[model samples]
Each structure stands twice: as C-alpha cells, then as structure tokens.
Target: MGKARETILEIDLRALEHNYRYLRSKLGPETKFLGVVKAFAYGSDSKRIALKLQDLGIDYLAVAYVKEGVALRNAGVTKPILVLHPQAVNFDQLIEHCLEPSIYSPRILRAFLKTAKKHRQKDYPVHIKFNTGLNRLGFWENDVSHITEEISGGTELRIHSVFSHLAASEDLNEVDFTQKQIETFDKITTQIDHKLGYRPFRHLLNTSGIINYPEAQYDMVRSGIGLYGFGNEAQIDAELKPVATLKTIISQIHRIEPGESVGYNRAFFSNGYRTTATLPLGHADGIGRQYGHGKTYVEVNGQKAFIIGNVCMDMLMIDITGIDCKEGDEVIVFGKNPNADRFAATADTISYELLTGISQRVNRLFIGD
Candidate 1:
C-alpha cells in the first residue's frame, strides 16, 4: 500500500482474506471451500497464499501438479491438497507428502492404485474426475462403471470426491451448455453412488461456476481467480479486492523529437515532440509484446500513460508527454484502478494468463498478515 520505489509485486493478504470471506458468504454452512493455489497462487507466492487460506480455515487446497502440492507440504501446509493433474512418475512422492490426486482416467487410476499398494497404504484419499463437458481431462460417463468396478476390490485408494470442470460457467451465453454439463455430472455421480453402494462427496463449480451457477454447488466449490481478486463479471469484481499490485518506478525520462524511433524494430516514430518514461520491467517480467504500441496503458502519477513502441525483454517505455512525472516516480502497471481483467483485455487475453505469466524474478512485498 506504499509508494513503489522499485519494481515489485505487492501481495495483499488482507485482500485475500476479504475475497475468501466474501466467497464463503455465498455458500451454505456445510459447503466446503477449496482454494486453488496452482501456478504460484496465480503468479503470486503460493506458499504465502496457501498459508493465509489455511489460517482462514479453508477446507481444501488444490494445485496443478504433484510438485506444487509437495512444495506446500514442505512449507507446513497441512490442509488437504488435491493435485489436479498428478503424473504417474510422481505418485510415490505425492503419497509420501499426503497429497490427494484427481484420478481422471483409467491409466492414472491404475497407476495410482499400484503406487499406493506399493507404499502399503490404505484408504488414501483420491478424487474421481468426470468429463462432464470439458474435454480437457477426466473419464467419460460410461467410464463411471469402470471406475467403480476397479476401486470396489481395492483398499489402497478411497474415492474422496467426484468432481468436474465447467467449460463456460463464467459466460452467460453458454448457460444451456453449462446446465447440460451439470446434468451430466449429476447422472455420473448418481451412477457412481449406486454402483459403489455409497456416496462420495461431489463438487462441480469453479469460481465463476459458484457465482453464476450456484445451484450446481454440490459438496464443495473451487476458486482460483476469484481468490486472487477477479470475478470475470463487473458486478462481482466490485465486491472483491485484487490481491496483487504490480508497481515500478520510472528509471529515466526521455524527450523525443519528430521522426525519432523507439525500441525494437523502430516500432514507434514520434510525429512531434513528446516525452516518454522507461520502467524496468518488460516481456521478461510478463508484460507481453502484444501489450505494446499504445494498446495498453499504465498509470503514472495518477494519469494514464499509454505504452509506446515494442516491449523489450527487461524494460518498457510509456508516453508521458503531458504527465507531470519524473524518474523514480511510482508507476502502476495494473492493480486497483485498471485491475488485471481490464489490463489483460487490451491484448485480447484473460486475467489468468496475465497473472500467471508474471516472472518469478519480480520482488514480492506483502502487506497484511
């Protein structure tokens, strides 16, 4: 919350707590909450975010890979961690760290069972993933019977929950498709419950799914972007505070005359006298090349300074002709005012890509415990 004297990504833990509490307020008392801390907690520090969520009494945590879960375990995270995409090779390490795996296919299920048995483990919690509509992963509806049959005779693994990914819960235009996916997931769960003669907890909502399709929130809800301060919709965004703010200082200011070019490939030719400010962050720091050429702008001294020319690997220039800013003045790349969603829109991308693309080299400063 202080002025930026150097390039840094400020992580606001209080904002994270606010977002968590806000999302929890939408759920029933019994509904569980799973915080997705994959990709360095959406390009912020995952260990810190996970710890904050843990302190907030989160029911579960999720990561994209086994290594991420192991890292959390190493950092003293004791809450249940679901590895969304556990590989066969790391099944041993996953079990050793007490990380749960989402068994989406027959091959992974079989591999995990073997690994669990080899480790002499019993009743190890594993989630079953159903391919409701997101063709990315998960077993088909017909494969439900196969999953039940395979697990029925084994004690090495236990189906902790059955879950599915919603393809377009954030897009209202895809309501029909999303409803059908929910219906299909319902049928799959019903079949699994019937065949297994018991019920495994079910979950089928992501962040947007929790907001747009609350009816489908079965046993738990998973939130990734929302916890990081984006809600995909303007109204919901207003209720949440962004947890990451990228800030930098003007390294230098330049006065350009007419016909003077700037940056790589002479991307910008000044038509008149203008002033530009260079910041020590660029494509290598996750401000991609597509955001160049005045497509996107950053805030300098509370004024909009459009980016000019191509973004270099470690620096970028912004037009500051009329702005009253100088070297060492704070510049906001994206945060409260513009927010990640609006900033990402200039390049036709989403907040997820921008947030996750931030280079790890950027110094992270935390505010709020």
Candidate 2:
C-alpha cells in the first residue's frame, strides 16, 4: 500500500535553502538578512518556513501585521520578528509577543510611544519607515526632524532601524529614480543620525533592491519574493529553483463529440472529438476563472495540456486529447518543469500573486528542512 493521492503543494526546503544561499552570496557576511515571511511566508506555510529560516541564521523575520508575528511567536520562533504594518490597536499584542513595529507616521510613532510608556517599557526597539518615493506608508523626508524631536523626548522607545521602500528597483529603465531614492534614504538617515546622536541600523532595499542595487545594501536587506525563487530577471531566475510545486491528480476523464460543449456556460466547444480531464481544483484553490478557455495549462506525462472550458469553484477541465494519462495520474499546475513564472505570465500576473493566492485548503508537504 502507498499514500493516497490528493492535491498538494510540495515544498522543497532544499530549494528554499538554495535560494537563500544564492541571495546571501550577493552580500557581505556582516550585512544582516531579513527574511520577509508575511502573507503566510508568501502563501507557503509560515510556521514551517519561519522555523527553517530561523535555523538558517536569518538575522530577522518580517510580517505584515501583529497577529502574524504572534503566530510566529506561538510557533516557538525565537528570532526577532518585525511587524511591517503594525496598527495601534495591536500594540499590546505586539509587545506581548516581543515583536518590533515599523512606525511609519508621526501619529503611529506618538501612539506607540504612549503605549510603550503605559507598558512601562524602556528603550523599546522600533523601526522607522520613510517615504522616499513609494508614496505608501512612512514619514516624508521633511518629517524627519519631527520624528527626531518626538523620539528624543521619549525614554520608552529607541530607533532600531530606518528603512524606505523602493518604487521601481526592478525596472532597469528607472535606474535614475532608484538612485534618487537611495540618495533620499541616505539623506534622511544622516539627518536622523545627526539629530539622535547615534546611528541605528538602516535598510532601504526589498528583494529586487538586493539584486539591482547591491551597493545600497546598507546595514540590512529584506528578501521577499527572491527567497521564494523569483528574481524578476532571467539570468537570476535561472540560478534559483522554485520551492513550491502545486500538484494534483486527475479525478475523471471525458470524451466529447464535435459541436459538444464542456463545463458550465459551455465555455469550451469541441470542433472535433476531444479528450479532457477534470482536476479536483479550481478558483477556490487559487486557480482563477481567468485560466479557462485555453489560457492556462497543466502538465501531464511531461506534455502541456491546455485547460479547456471554464474553471469552476472546485473543478477545472483540461484538454488531454493527445496526452497519455489516466484517471489517477499526477498533474502539475506549476513547478520546475512548467515553472510558476511562466504559468503566471500566461494569466497576466506574477509569481508573487500566484503563490500568495494559493488557498490554505491545499495541504503543504515539506522536504529537506
């Protein structure tokens, strides 16, 4: 007897390690590596990924909110966790879980300082985000003086690091804009340092920044999609192996005659005899409806089988007319052979969206931790 077949996300931790090492090789040993594990470690199991990164000596781990950090803490992750977008409401839990928050606005800074004082904290470490060009969260460059003033008057909080998001680090044509951002971040950090009388750790690079702007590595670097096997560059993507492979089994098969339609809405009509396989996966499992009508495909017996008909809530039909496969044969939605990037491109998306869109219902199987 063998294990029963089912839809699963096979996670190769060895491949993850390879990606990590490859990215690490780009920087000096002294530079800190912050693994971005938000969004359930980019839709892989967060606890599992975080634990492995913790063991791999990742200098820090970051998440989108306080609850994600609390989940990591509950999972026995001892590494420093940074809450990238912490709301004032969760300040209690953030402190309780020993999670650091990135105070982006003056209001957030003041609120967190007040909360720290109420908790009777001393020298609580907090990261500060600046708005160099992203126009998202973070204080503006002009706000630096006010930030310094507020922090100086507070005994409960200390600046742990200063960081800014790059608006277009991955676009080579936007090199001038990227360089200007680097300059702005540098200018802001210098002014803050001069005012505070000491320099905290500084980081202004995301995953692409690490690749496209290596010189701005500064005191730390944050690796997000890059660690998940995407570099947004052909040469780098070739060197990194994708870690998660979405796989499933053929649940059933059907043969349709000419002029016969398939699936709901009769989205696919057979001009001639056609063979199709119904997989036990659909938009609910993160394969969106847009993948229907021969836009996307799955691999069967090493051949690409175009997905025919509409993708349903729990099923999808793929044309397998010339493919040699059985009811129980394995099917690959995305992995090493087809790869996520190529599959995502077919849907006019990116690997980040595809990976993060995977529903939690799909079981994850980890290997080589």
Candidate 3:
C-alpha cells in the first residue's frame, strides 16, 4: 500500500487467546468450550480469530449464520462449527461445509432432515435448541415430545448437542430469572434425553453463565463476548483483554475562531477559539452520529478531544484545542489507554454495539500472538 490508511482497527489476538484460556480454565475438563466467532468475530476478524482459536485447540467454533460458518470452513478451519441461527435456505450449503445447524423449530428441523436425506448423509449431526428463556430461537417446551419422537424414529440424524440461550446471564440482578431459564432448559434436556435415549453434548452457559454459575456449566459452554474481551462481570473483565482497537489518522488540522459554528446543523458552537482536527472516519465507519456534539473524542498526544459537531458520512471534526497534533497524526478512538468501551460509554452505549457497528470499509489489522 502506498501509505497506510487513515482508518484502521487493530485487533489483539493475544487478548483473544487470553480470554479463551481464562474461560476454559473456569470449566472442568469434561465441559468443552465453543468459541463464538459470529458477526466477523464481533467486528474484529473471524477468519483470523477462528484460525488462532483452532490452532490453540478450541473444542469447537460457532457462528450465527451458515455463511459465517462457511467462511471459516473456507479459511481452512476443519473443526466442527455450530450455526446458531442458520437459515432454511442455507441448510444444503451448511451440510456441504460440514457445519452443524442448531435446529429450533419443527419446520426447520423437517427442512434440514429432508436436505440430509437428499445428500445421503448418514448419522448427520445437528444440535437441538430449546427455548428455555430467550424465546428468540429454539424449540418450545411443548415441542419436546415431538423432537424426541422424531429423533427416536430416525437413525440417519444424530443429535450432537442440546443447548439454550441465556436470556440475561450478565445481569446478576436477574439471578432468579436466569436460574429459571437454566432449570427449564435442564428439564427439557432431561426429558428429551430420556425419551430419545441419546446422550448429546449439553451446553447452556455463555460467557456470563460461566462467570456466575459454574454449577450450571454443562457438557460445553458457548462464549461470544468473552472472547472479544467483554464480560458483564467486572471481575471477569479484569482478567480479559480488549481485542479490538479503533484508530484513525488526522486528515487535516485547523484553527477555529471564537463563536464559530462547526459541522452540519451547527450542532456545536465554540465559545472559545480553538484548534480542530479532522478524522477520515465517521458514522459510516461505526462512530455513530450521536457521538457528535461533544459526545465522543479521540486521544490526541495523550489528551482527549471532543467531537465538534454532527458526524458526517465520511468524516468528523474533533476539538483538538491546545493539543500538539497535525495531519497524519494517529488518533486513538478506542484502544489500550482510552479503550473502546470507555469511548462508547460517553454515548451511553456498550463496546458490543460499537464493535459490531464497525463498517466493512475500515481496514482491520491483527497484532501479537
């Protein structure tokens, strides 16, 4: 490349590994771990993270869609993958990639079974999702009998895992609700396991679940946010490292006069004369327009500079007053000292929202082991 791009995301794979090892340490050897790399590894880079995790010997990998799983497979990841929210249309491709689908509804199960039969796949692996609490995806409790009956009658299909989503595992305040979800999932799994006479891999604990409920950590745990360096529990976060760092370069620097208005809609009117810096990244690059008008900032020479106005489509201006910085100067939007979560905190949001919101146009760079 002629010159390094102004906008880039630095992903720390070492932190990713640290998070994985920390989570893995919490669970017993019997309980396997599945690394969730969906949403481009939570807006980092799934291919890189998945490959690293695979090399580190993660028990399994997971993705939200069939295409996400396919991407991992295309990247030479031979480990088993769970498609968390697989679409009906991609069942064939999922099967082709040797990716397992988490079948929740009877309609989807039937469609996938049909596909397996057409492919002449014997002992085709699948995971059953129960709607213990999330209610977003998974088979309802009432459908347990149907699932068991279907499983018992068929020998071509094999149940690989039975799992449920935690409605709010991170919220300690929702302890009772989370317990109820765990209890409900347990009952469903026991009832189905008894009827079908199959001992499938059982998992319910996510990153939060692993932190708060070691007792509930079943045969395997699926962790998403944990791998990306966020666990709702402060103690857990203390042990985890943030993986994605958002950085940009100053395209230009300018001096503004007192009483001058900046950006569209004149959202920011400076009371004092100040110096400003223009960044080549903006709302289109994942910095929400809401962050404009003094809600966000970039680190300039170890100091924070607030956004001056409404964020534009491709750029934003920051009040770099009193800071010694210029064009080509690096601005740390979120990383290390001034982390992304803290940066997002100014906008009343979380790191997850900001990371997943990172647009594809921004370049991604991976660093360290």
- Candidate 1 lDDT by residue in tens digits, 202-300: 999999998998888899999999999999899999999999999999999999999999999999999999999999999999999999999999999
Candidate 1 stretches greater than 4 Å from native:
none
Model 1's alpha-carbon lDDT is 0.94
TM-score ranking, best first: 1, 2, 3
Report how far residue 92 has shifted in candidate 2, in Å. Answer: 0.5
What are the lDDT scores of the predictions, listed in order?
0.94, 0.92, 0.87
Score candidate 1 by TM-score against the native: 0.99
Q: After superposition, how far is residue 230 of candidate 1 from its true place, in Å?
A: 0.8
TM-score of each: 0.99, 0.98, 0.96
Clashing pairs for model 1 are none
Candidate 3 residue lDDT tens string, 1-369: 122357998888888888889999999988888999999999988999999999998999999999999999999999999998998899889888899999989999889888988898888988999888786988898898898777667666898889998989889899999999988988988887887776887999988899998999889998998999888766777888999888888998888888888888988887988888888988889888888888777787789898878999999999988888778988888876667677778889988888899999999887886
For candidate 2, lDDT tens digit of each residue in 49-115? 9999998899999999999999999999999999999999999989988999999998899899989
